[model samples]
Target chain A: MKLLQLAVAVLLVAVLGGSPLSAGARTWQIDPAHTNFYFTVDHIYSKVRGHFNTYSGAINFDPQRLGESSFSFKIATDSIDTNLAKRDKHLQSADFFDAGSFPEMTFASTKVVDAGQGRYDVHGTFTVKGVAYDLVLPLTFAGVKEHPAMKGKEVAGFNGTLVLDRLAYKIGDGKLYKLGVVGKDVEVLVTIEALADK
Target chain B: MKRTLLQIFFLGIGALVVAGGCALPFLYPTQTLWYKTGWEKAVLQTGHLFGVFAFLALVLQLLFGSRGALLERAFGVSLVMRLHRANGQILPLLVLCHMALVLLPEGLANLPLGLTFWPEMVGGAALLAIVVQVVAAQVRQRFSLDYRRWRSGHRWLGYTVLLLAAVHVLFVADSFASGLPRLALLLLVGMMALRLVYRMVSSRR
Candidate 1:
């Protein structure tokens, strides 16, 4: 029992970390060419897949920093593609996304928790079309490596997926709110490739 | 009785077919016959099929049941009522299927499947309105309220579907987009307007 207790204490201490990471310790710039934001919808009997074609964002990485690391991004709502032109327009109209009134969908991270093994669960507020909601993203790190495209530059990756219930933010709200015609629970798949500045 | 039954039988089979998946080409005004395009025609055909069933069920509900009798009749009343209920439930699914065929593809087709075409959003607000009413009806039913109140909701959704479809045929369609289909589409709207006027005048009396 004494041996087990000591082992548990050591594990807890190691897991807890020596100290919380300070703010602005390490800032990472996003590479637009590498990042992607994809979403899915239920199209009646079938499922429709789409994504935002244009977006830009930056991330501040501080592993132990809960409130220190900041992330922000803006995606052009009009650049959304389900591959269909007319439906995309309808999605932007009043009955659906109302992208005309509220164009850019944005997200800014508030806090991130290190879950060991270079994994993190980021809590961020995401504004889609116009509605805002708190989002939790469970992320897996792809590790830092020498970027093949850029000489002497290192890039870090984090891939995460989250189910977004459109009704929460009222993206396509109201009764027809039915996954009936539209879809319920849009999948938000994000791939962030950030570069270390120094 | 048999003629009505025959019409209903055909309508039922067609509705189930289009509603369930096999979208057969059937056009209104009875003139164009089965002229169809790749998929839009499939959707129109399905919606038309559902409309046929809706019309049949409306007629059955109109002529068959004793709305006020309460508990008088048996056997046949229960049977017809059952059919009416079945038809009622299936009706919206068919409409939804039809709506998806036309609407979903406009956005989804761009993917690798090419199942949807990014076409035109010709319906001003009709489709949107229908979505609202349908949801309200479901809520009302779930809440165990009077189905009669749903009539108003039902009527509005129907009107929206018909109106928007007319506009859809006019501004958006490619082949039947203009000329005679336009005229016939207008005629359907006119008929709907007249029905509304008649109902309003009679209700006021």
Candidate 2:
């Protein structure tokens, strides 16, 4: 019985220390070049897609310190593009971005919550068109890797998706005029390739 | 009596312009997709609402013209009249968007003045002349000046706009088909021929 107890204790120590869940903090810098901010809106009864050409942000993560992780990101309102010149101008007008009044769009992370396996729930305050709203984005812990250029740095990457009812956020007037020219529901997909900060 | 033809011409041509604006389709896979086709930039800012108001304007203008003419052709002439004027004034403004994208500085640099601005100026002049003629015919009927001069100038200016605009779109639109320009060129020639024949027949009578 003594021998069995000793073995059990040893196993427990090994599991606690060496497990992937072990606590170690990491901070990541978003690779702005590789990052993409993509969104889609309703187009003439069908779906049309678009994205911002300019956006920058960072994410910090540590599996052990799930509650401590945070992120901050911002996209330039002027960077919006819809691939059609006529439609793009209209989107930027007071009818949409009203970019002149609200020059920048931003996102600042508040806290992280423990979600299921290797997953997390990140809460952030997002400001768009000068309106601030809190959002809970479901995130997948993609794992950490040593920074290619920095010897002591490690980066944590993640893929996250959030559904935004632009209506709730007051993106555009939800009232459909002349048979729904704009769509209310918007899904934002973010793929972050963040570089670790030493 | 002559104003009837003018209204019909404006309505017909206005519908063509409006329909053309609506039918414009887009193709992509470009890096500067926004700059190249930046409709959202305009729509979000001012063009969207402008589009609504302009369409409203077209209907209004159409209704005003229809007051003394036939009302049996359309339903709710009041509403449609609002749309007619809204569309008429707004279509050209909306064209500014496509112009901003497709007619980038480089595109503008290459087009001849005739294809670029002169033809439009001629068209503008012709339109102004038509307005003057309409006023003169209504207000100065005692002068009894012949109408053919103004009509001739207006017709020539319209032809100039048609020709130059065709050349302009062919050179710049990038979407021009293999034979469409040639077909349009032929149609222009055929229309000119038919109109001259009609003029000759009318003069003989």
User: In lDDT terms, how accurate is model 1?
Assistant: 0.61
The estimated TM-scores of all candidates read: 0.46, 0.49
Candidate 2 local lDDT, A1-198, one digit each (tens): 999999999999899876646645456778877677778766557888888888877666777776767878888876677785445544655556766578688988898887888778888898887778888877787877787776887766777877778777666565442335566777787877777545
Specify the highest-lDDT model's number: 1
Tell the DockQ for candidate 1.
0.04
- TM-score values for chain B across all models: 0.49, 0.38
Q: Fraction of native Cα contacts kept in each candidate?
A: 0.07, 0.00
List residue ranges in candidate 2 displaced over 4 A: A1-25, A147-154, B1-205
DockQ of each: 0.04, 0.01
Looking at model 1, residue A126 earns an lDDT score of 86
